[model samples]
Target: MRNSTALALAALLAGAGLTGGCGGASAPGHQGTPPKTGSSDINPQPRDSLRKGGTLRLSIQQWITQYNIGQVDGLQGDGASILTLTEPKLWFADDNGVPAANPEVLVSAEVGTSGGAQVVTYKLNPKATWSDATPITWQDFATQWKTRNGSDDRFQLSGTTGYDDIANVERGADERTVKVTFKQPYADWQTLFDPLLPGSAVDTPEKFNTGWIEKIPVWGGPWKIGSADKTSQTITMVPNESYWGTRPLLDSIVFRALDSTAITEAYLNNEIDQAPGRQPEAYRRLAGAANTVMRTGGRWDETQLTLGHAGPLADVRVRQAVTNAVDRAAIAAAQSAGLPFKVNTLGSHFFMPSQDGYRDNSGDEGRFDLERAKRLLDEAGWKASADGKTRTRDGAALKLVYVVNGNGSTDLPQLVQNMLGQAGITVELRKVPGNDYFTKYVNVGAFDLASFRQVDNVFPSLLYPVYRTGGDQNYGGVATPEIDKLIDQAGAETDRAKAAELLNRADALLWQAGHSVPLFQTPQISAVRPGLANFGAFGLRSERQYVDVGWTR
Candidate 1:
């Protein structure tokens, strides 16, 4: 199981309310030698009439969970991908998923304390404007802060442990200058700076504060929402001519829903350009085909096992037993041919080990051992049931419902269920639609166990929502005062050394407590057509989207 903070974030982001409208911008001529876009470097190409009007089909197993930017809780990475196709954040990660010091939309971003609240300052790009020709300004940031930071559902700042210190936000006398003041010192302030919301979108501060989450969002990105097929399963986007950044290469992009088997077939038949959620080896098989190219996926993107935080699961012995009972090496092999890395620790309060704070605890606490698992359960006062397939205490059977994305491979949970069975644990595998599945089942803490996956970013973005107690994303029904303290400090921590120390300590604590069972870190490798030059970051957050990419000869 992953940590509680990430689960909370997923639940909230699943319902984000964002609206987009884009037009064409002036194109820059091509410049650099033709190179893969998803590679480490941002190869700049000069402006020209891009290979326009070719339909790029994308098959992402599930539909986008939510449209709201601030309210979105769980699917932050997926939301980021969608925004890249339709909007621009003040500070976005470069092609490498590292936060760009200055993006095209915002000139600079810095965090500080103001009146006992964490304050974030944003300087807007003079050329940046919404699709409707509204210039992005400080008023927009202030209004977004007022609306999202003020709401109960909004997970952007104050409500989340990452931003618990943010007190308020205000605009400077100049429209381009804005400030966000926090309630306490937060370490993860950068999480809110990206994909900024527009002021024009929030005309009624009351509406936003009152849960009118359906409001159409105003966006400033390369593409705009062209045709939303609420009836069918397709969503079409066209290049926004008024975009402040480089003119988009493609005329239109389509996001279509397809079954897993059909997605692979579509890629082979040239019906789609790409598909997300395919296993690493499966993606490897299709890469470098006649019309396709494949690349390696990144860290901290894959399936996870979440132990319930409360009720029967709150027991440390139960959590430890579950962790040791499953063989992650086998699970990783089943998912990929040893391509995915085994993670034995409860995910660092944040998802990625590459981030500033990460500690491996799998060696000591998360080792796979059915005998030890049985011993732990026995010590916890559980004995075999009459059927010998389950453990019972005081006549109550140790039963768990394991939830996972039904559209993906069934082998993921089946392997886990089989492993747990060896320890006499009865796990009921429940497969559901990936779209908003986290929100429906995990968010409400409705299930006993859940197969989880989250796209991790630079640092602390997914922390508060996943770990903090009562966190909207805390679907695991679990929390610890120590974990909470470490995560909260990590959010406000500005110094790299201190933040890393706190996060490492927190990761160790989680493993000791058996809060989550570490699975493998999934890769972002995928197949792409040869002509597609810029693939962007190859993970969950930055997938095979065409936002910061184009064709080059």
Candidate 2:
């Protein structure tokens, strides 16, 4: 399973609180081209048009087991998605995932260097307080730092990228101000504190990992947990009376856990007000529904193939052959066929095709060339059997176990299996429980190959935990000194241009190493009530203002 910290930060930044600003030129010091408005199927509704006092019933793929996003058990995307509603970060991203100061939580945040060390000072809004009326303080910041800084293994932190580099977290003259000093420069420091765990949650290891299970003892955002029913597979949330920002327009939000297969039906039956339109059949079904609008856009999440290094994939040639054998374009077409909007195959591992700095570094390896794939396998000593249906090396057949959570359409994996079989590769499909898929298979290296999607970050530093050696989310167990040095160099560089160059260089090494194969970007698809404001499939802007999502008239 991915660590809670990096996953939380990525989900938060990619899909946290919303900010105001139209598309503009790339920010100074940032690399890549500026974000494009791009193709979107969502019908925009003005915030002022929304009415107040209603409950929004939403569908979630999985029931959350842990309330704290900082713990390993709570690192799942479903938990992070829920936390976005209940936990407010000091800094949030605009619709484009651009880091923006959140005045609701922080009055201002300034970054600079002092004594050759990078420093960040945050000034909190005086009115900001938790649900219990506890004022957010420097203690909260310090508690989070100490608990997640990797000093104590018992805490089970999701990541230690920026936290491990932190030398000290000091409070200023008052509780409203806190200063953070990093031993080395962390260019993406602004992305650090959105899903900040409260002092009560992080004060002890037991509290950090177990206290938040099924119960949210603290709240810092616009809403507070009202109740959760495991039997009903539902969680209810109410407006936080202590909230200092705009009062939430909706009386409450009910997140109901539903099977992915049943989500579209739930939407159709009026059991849920919104459902993701990822499946073409679902989108087509929802398209004709009354009082509903189909929204589609380029999502930050990218589907990829992760090969385990400890199993049959340990041979780099095998990984390379597999990469060349799969046809990404065909896969994208099959997934998006007959859909309302077109979807594109993702080329880069780090940036989206539309984003700045994105390049097709996959080279010839990404193409679907069975000849080259077979040649590579032959070079690696995997000879075709007499039947020519599968390859064998030293009497052991080239069999690969492909595992996935039994959710949504199986077309992707089934297609991959069929394609690989044509190239004499035997792929065994293993479906795991969606709830334990990450922890049981992906995290523990229980399968030869796995398929999953990841949301990209605005800055490259967020990639550290996924590609760096010994990273908490390094699924493939890729460890190389060259890769490590390049990643560290990129993280420490203050100059965005230089960092982008270093990141691109490092990406080349990743492709050469065949760490993972980039498949295609999942089109952000959703069916929403026509009057539903501030809620739908968004591009770089994934965060929604929970307080503002409601019906219009």
Candidate 3:
């Protein structure tokens, strides 16, 4: 559970078009060649080229609200990115989002069936310890499990699907081992327990939610929080001397809060070593910088328009009309304009085009057919005004509130507004502060339609929160029993082929219902210092081995 909260947070920021190029793959036409890893390649470098001591400087869109990412208010992209260096996951997801075991923390994780129930036994590495030298034990696991299982609402967790499904968590012989028996089978079992918090951090609701808001006392990975400055909006981390795994290459890592618009300037000024280059304008500006390389590739992140089921968008026909009225291709082209690679319009809400089991469920809904859109709106009781500038239904104009983060360029939303205006829909664009974008607008359902990109996990089963009825992240209020059934069926499946089939079927329902419009899969574009190695966007791996990130001197 590598900060599951951060996963959604990253998606939220990506959706807002802030850091669209953060995860997975280089941009379409990378100009430079990456160093090849031959048989003589070092563990984390090419031969003896890695330099071990330097401060890695990075930038983020906003300051983290809380240190604990599991809490609703604390779940954020900045915090999650920082935690990646401080936390230990049972497994790390590859660039393609596939989960793989991490032997640094886990000796082995065995999954089996006992009495028709699913069972997982995790054996911890004997040397695993916190920064304070406390042994990582089963008690820590039980503490986190009890706080986040959803049985108790005081902890304010982001999601509890997996934890709630567990029948029991018991110690296996000694503190070094534990067994988790699931009341129901969870096919994505490998996705759990990145690192369990010490008992002090999760022993109670108050401790779980507010204890780490200012400082995270517990540390279990290669790096521990060194210093956090609220005034300067920076957090510095240093290597955890007690780490049992191979020592990290960098002496320290510093994450600073900077406006998304200033990232390119910062990189140019040498204030930061690397920054995402998803924005076409920024990529163009940094394309010829000295000692820098721009890498790009397709990312799992996607931008889309989410309809609020309670407003004028309540009618499925109205949602369909809105989806059809917008020209998705134009929006994608505008975002990718001047870039070296061609951008494709994304069609599936569940899987990217490059991923397996992807299907173009967009069908006619994704096509820009103003005539069809008008027909659908007219059928939904909205009639165009005499001047043909707007639609009126029962004496009220078909007006919509479009909410987005205020930090990035408004070109995309403005383009969407113009396209929908042709269909007689009036859009009022609301630019909220970037820090408050998720809590004030997205989570509160304060907008009639919201636009943001979402980052997805490798396992489709992990997507239940966005589509499942009454799920924590289901801000669209999409409640369909049939879709829920398919999600459940897919999660219960042990066969990968069958799970993909069921998930696609559920995704089809999402498309037809006009729950959301799938947009383009943003490419991961970033400019890094020439000698910087083992960092930045990758195609097959999502998680970064910070221990391996260094400079080739």
> What is the alpha-carbon lDDT for the whole of candidate 1?
0.59
Report the backbone clash tally of model 3: 17
Candidate 2 at 533: error in angstroms?
A: 1.5
Query: Which sections of candidate 1 miss by over 4 Å?
Result: 1-53, 72-80, 95-97, 101-103, 110-120, 150-163, 200-216, 276-281, 284-288, 338-356, 385-388, 536-548
> Which 10 residues in a row give candidate 1 its minimum summed lDDT?
17-26
Q: For residues 391-433, could you state the per-residue lDDT of candidate 3 as single tens digits? A: 9988998999889788667888899899999999999999989
lDDT-superior candidate, 1 or 3: 3
Q: Give the alpha carbon lDDT tens digit for every residue of 1-553 in model 2.
A: 2223212001111222222112222222332221243333334566578777899998777778876767766667667767767776766566557777778888888888899888889998888888767888888899989988889999976677788889999998698899999999898887677666688766999889889887778878888889899999999889888777877889988988887899989989998888876676875576667767655555466778887886668888888888888998889878766454345687777777777678788887777889999999999999998876899988898999999787645778899999888789999999888777776778777888888877645556666878888887777786578989998998888887788778888888887787888787766667777777777656666455576677878
Question: Candidate 2 — what's its lDDT?
Answer: 0.74
Clashes of each: 71, 8, 17
Please report how far candidate 3 places residue 165 from its true position, in Å: 1.8
Model 3's TM-score against the true structure: 0.91
Best by lDDT: 2
TM-score of each: 0.82, 0.91, 0.91
Span of ten consecutive residues with least summed lDDT in model 2: 6-15
